[model samples]
Target: MWRYCSLLAQLVMHLDTFRVSRWLKRWRPPPWPALLLRVAVYSGLWWVITEGSGSGWLGLVLALLIALCAPLNVATWPQQLRWRRLPLFIGFMLKNSLFGALIVAQLALSRRCSANTHTRTYRFRLLKGHPQQLLMANLVNLTPGTLTLRLGCDTLSIHILHYQPQIEAQLMMLESHIAALYGLDHEPWEYEY
Candidate 1:
């Protein structure tokens, strides 16, 4: 009986230690660079939304609040964002946006528009709950004729206005660009029709 009691006490101690370690890990502050980057990005977004209406103090304050309140997983950010690839990613998105606009314009102006709209479910190579996955979904919505209907754990359901052979290729390219931005390898995944 005494031995069993000792073992039980030991187990309880181990469990407590595990809990403490997890708590510390969860509450620890993020790295300085990552924190600063978050603040800058948030501030920039606020500025863009507000169109530089008033003093930048409110934007700075909001940025700080958001940065501090958000969960900071330092391990992910360093591996996720590659600063060198930012320009390429932005340029790719802009170019795709332009092409998408042109396609939409052509379809709109045509007298006999043969629109064959369909929904496609593509398997995303990015891991579930990854920030880049959400960003990619938003970008898809911004692109003309393509709207992200559902973003599941491993699948993305997109509504395509006009089914084109090159649409899948463009989506793949866009995914690759986003993966590159996140410093992740772009791998082919099984997609559903």
Candidate 2:
């Protein structure tokens, strides 16, 4: 009975240690780039709300306030960008955005066109931080056809306006570009799609 009790106590201690380690791993200081993005978005919304009036200066202040007040729940800061790859990524986004817009317009304007909308959950290979998930969500939301519905641990639930076999490929390509922007070198096993 003494030995069994000792084993049970040891197991409880080990479980407590595991829980503490997991908690420590999850909590981290937020990064600067994320703060900057929040500030920019808040400021942009303020400007829009004020309608380009003489109150633009006030908008900037409000933006700063909101950004500072917002809670940050980052696990780890995303990897730094490879500055050399930024232009390429930007160009890729712009080009794809233009085409996506054109396709959306065609689907909208053509009476005979039928859009096969579908939602899919994609488990990414290399995306790690919340920042990467946020960026991917925004990118998908902004693109004409795809709407990012939810982001979960290692999974993105996206609604595609026009579902096609190639849509998954396009999304993977987009993810790769984003990974490049984050300076992540992808390992084949890290990606599910």
Best by lDDT: 1
Please write out the lDDT profile of model 2 over residues 1-193, one tens digit for every residue: 9999999999989988778766655545345887787678778887777686648778778877666555434333333757789898888889889988998999989998888989999887777778887899889876668988899887999999988888888888888889878877654553333
Off by over 4 Å in 1: 1-27, 39-66, 69-79, 186-193
Return the lDDT, model 2, position 13. 92
Candidate 2: Cα lDDT at 77: 33
Model 2: lDDT equals 0.78
Model 1, range 78-139, lDDT digits (tens) per residue? 44578898988788778878888998899989999888999999777544455778888999
- Model 2: how far is 108 from its true place, Å? 0.9
Clashing pairs in 2: 125-190, 125-191
